[model samples]
Target: MAKLFEPFTIKNITLKNRIVMSPMCMFAVEKEDGIVTPFHVTHYESRAIGGTGLVMVEATAIEPRGRIRPSDLGIWSDDHIEGLKTLTDRIHAHEAHAAIQLGHAGIKAQTNDIPIAPFSEEGTVTAMTPHMIDQMIDQFKVAAIRARKAGFDIIEIHAAHGYLLNQFLSPLTNKRSDAYGGTREHRYQVVKKVIDAVKAVFHGPLFVRISADEYHEAGNTAEDFIYFSQEMKAQGVDLIDVSTGGVVNVPINVFPGYQVAHAEMIKRGADIATGAVGLITEAAHAEEILNNQRADLIFIGRELLRHPYWPKVASEALNVELEAPTPYKRGWN
Candidate 1:
């Protein structure tokens, strides 16, 4: 079997291949009510048809207020179940395992708002109190229940990109001198609570995405992620989806695979399953990452968005035949 086309299993789920569609926020849902639309369905279904082994839904808000933008998809209530169910069933019909990335926005809650960049703007962020933290945990638990009901095979908690959980994990953003801040263990408490709550409600596998390093002058380092990964594994986290930067302003001058070192560190330091994402476009590059045992999975973001049939093209380029959906045989070029 081709290295990238080989099957691999994580807990109770088995991925037909290693090529996974990285979670990309499409902001396709209609209205501010966070309703899933046909656009959302078609976006993911197309990826499934393109032969991705595991199709992860975009960064879904676990709470309505956690929405990054007005049109982002969400799973905060029971009403979202039907639409998500439709999307999951459609992806599965194409023979791909469906996964959902659930998360809260935290300090970076509304960073995507163009007019008022939270980093530069003041008075927009509502400091999350201890009670609010508990409420956030409950929201994640309920959202996981909804995702499981929606037919998702795996659930990944979005902890990267300086999102809610990431904010708490980063000392730079989390200035709260309380239990949810100060020390590394305390900062991690918020996500740990959310994880415990979700595991109680959902029996399937759980994955956590993390910014191995904030990639800033005053950000968490690779050593920080190694410790976080160790704690995550101890808390029953199945995989660490490693990505970097985003805590502060990004320097566009950084070279490609600059973040891959974070993935390599987490895998080696923690000896757990890790995924290397960011600018991973070529087949040889992806295969080499896996072959080198740097990361167990490779998540393609912008590249997959530019080419929904990337998995198909990658298969052909790698001399591997990906299983195309039956009805699309004529267009399998």
Candidate 2:
């Protein structure tokens, strides 16, 4: 059985270990033009230097209005290229594969501009027109091309967490009667276009993050994602990063490794590689997920935030020898 430190490979790219630094928004792009600052560069490189096998950067907006916050990294234009390249270069310098999550915040966008969604439940807002949908897909494609130019090893499409793609995915929000809504397959139209667009430019390993369970009885379940995951795989997604909740603003019962089962189900049901995320803080527990063949990778979120050195410490706990940066080697046991 593979351990937490075991490597995972797909489509010619290999992650040195199973530990992935899940994308977490820092809202540190103080420039306000969707450009990342030095904080973003250092933020990701620290985890790379700390021995994380893969450092997935925070959700980077594909359009000015798609930003989750006023201050968030973006790849909407060519001007954002150099800054992102600097980030990936630093992570690669530490031998960690770098990835970027491309996303659109939709109605949840924290901007002055009125947000858009499949169907607006709030005050007057634009329901994305067919032309707007095409533009959005193009934006994702262009962002992906820019990420490849920035030297990202992987590109993860953020289709989960009630984001734009998620809005189109869930029946709770997507009540449209057009070709882009209603039935499950119809609702998946936008995501399929986004994935196809990304694949056109990015031949590298691709991943899609999805909320396997919406926690609302009327919302999607893990079983529903089995087919969605397969659809993602067919569109060239190399892996499914399984996460749950955020489709609705409901309180969910949180527990350690609570979402591991979702990842397991998607992996077995969709016949695709999957990554487990959500309150998974323990190295032993992460190893158990891999050893049991439940998940190909474990994405650590808040734990990695509270302790950037968690990967190094986790390596020790697992009796795995992970090399530290030369300057930090003295801190190693």
Candidate 3:
């Protein structure tokens, strides 16, 4: 097995370690205008300094209305680039590569505020129109360009978590009868364009975050993901970030490595690199995923949030490192 702390390379970018800081929306941004705040920079900086190899910033909306929360960071405008640049520079200084996850919330848009269609009996989200969908595609392109200016080494498209792209993949949510919905290929058209546009602006590796299974009572299936992953790989996606079950109306019962199955499936089924996320906390568990070749990378979310020094601690626990961070060297006993 390639040890978890060993450097891993994808394309021209070589991560100092296999540990990746998965993007988690903290809703820490102050406004919906997509401006990067000091809080966002500080939040990510902590992780970078903790010794993560790839510090993927949180889910940044590509457009204003496409935002999931009122305070989500965005890369839609030039104004957002400077703050993002500060984040990238800080992470780089700490020997970590920076990545941005660009996405639109789609019909799941504005979960924190505003109104749209197919509202619950209590009234909430509304389905997006064809016009809104088209605008989102363009927004993704513009956001990708902004990310490049901000000095991101990689751009991951958020197509998972039952957001806009996942909604389209679901027969339950996507009721559109046009080219935007129905059938597998037509449902994926919007995201495919988003990927293509982002690739045009980003010169480095590209990643596509995907929900391998919608896990809805009546929802998109693993087969749906297989088809989607295949198309995504064909479109030049560098890796598939596999996660599952974000659209459930009730709490989901899952165990550790529950989502790893999705990653394993996509990696083998599509013959592409996959990043396994969710409940991947322990060093042994992450190592197992790599040893089995189930995933190319292990993305830790809540665990990293709880212990920013997870990589360093894990390296020590695995007995694989010569020393810990200089400041924390004494604490590494």
Candidate 4:
């Protein structure tokens, strides 16, 4: 059997295949209230029906101000749970494990009020106060509870792409002189607390997405990520969803599987499972990564959007028979 189609288990959840529909913001919430809409239900369910092993909901904001956009999905209020539950039910009904990316956009958040970050950027962003830091950690904890109530199989903390958490992890963005800054361990203080808080309430497999490379001379280096990965492994994080860039906005040279090396490094350095992402659109490349023990999972992003039935396409390319949904079996065969 092709490695791409092989079942992989993490904790109690077993993915029928290694293909993860990486979290990408849909910005489809029309009301700007941070609630999931019918579009979200249909969007995620389609990928599930298309044979994705894990359908991860987009980067969902933990609070209103945390939203990357006004229309981003929110988990701050209890009212958001019902809609999220409905969406997860549909994905599970299609035999795909449902996951949600819990995130806070921070200085990257597009809102009327000032955005928050690890350090103040004068007119650009507001530095987080100690009280605000405590509040943010609680927000992550509360968001994890809502994810459980929403019936998600896995909860991924979005610390990548220069979002709130990534802001703390990167030196280019975080210049705080307090305990949350200075040393690498100090820079990791907030992320560590967030992980601990979430794990206290969440018992299932937990994942953290991190920008392994910031694409700048002074940004966090590979060694820095290795250390961070080891810390996360010690904190009971099940998987490190490895990604790169978006930390300092420097230009990145994109190519197929460009970020896979970081995933492989973290896996080997930290001795933990990792999911490889970024421009991995081909089945053979994904198989090579898994077969060679470079990464544990393949996270498909833009390609999944271009081809919802990408798993089926990959199965065929890898010469494996993927069972389609009952109604589509005849045509799929």
Please report the candidate that would top TM-score against the real structure: 4
- lDDT, candidate 1, at 247: 72
> By how many angstroms RMSD does model 1 differ from the true structure?
2.7
Stretch of 10 with least lDDT, candidate 1: 112-121
- lDDT for position 108 in model 4: 91
- Candidate 1's TM-score reads 0.94
Q: Candidate 1 clashing pairs? A: 105-164
So what's the TM-score on candidate 3? 0.92
Report the number of clashing residue pairs per model.
Answer: 1, 0, 2, 0
TM-score for each predicted model, relative to the true structure:
0.94, 0.97, 0.92, 0.99
Candidate 2 minimal-lDDT segment of 10 residues: 1-10
Clashing pairs in 2: none
Best by lDDT: 4
Candidates, ranked, TM-score: 4, 2, 1, 3
Q: What is the C-alpha lDDT profile of model 1 across 91-138, one tens digit per residue?
A: 999889999999766565553542211122357546666777787889
Q: What value of lDDT does candidate 3 attain over all alpha carbons? A: 0.82
Q: What tens-digit string does per-residue lDDT give for candidate 2 at 1-333?
A: 238877788898888888899999999988788787888877898999888999999999999999999898889999999999999999999989999999999988989889989987568677999999999999999999999999999999999999999999998889999999988889888999999999998999999999998988898766668878999988779999999888889998889999999999999999999999989998889888888999999999999999998988887787778776898767785
Off by over 4 Å in 2: none
Q: What pairs collide in candidate 4?
A: none
Q: Which stretches of candidate 4 lie over 4 Å from their true place?
A: none
Residue 95's C-alpha lDDT in candidate 2?
86
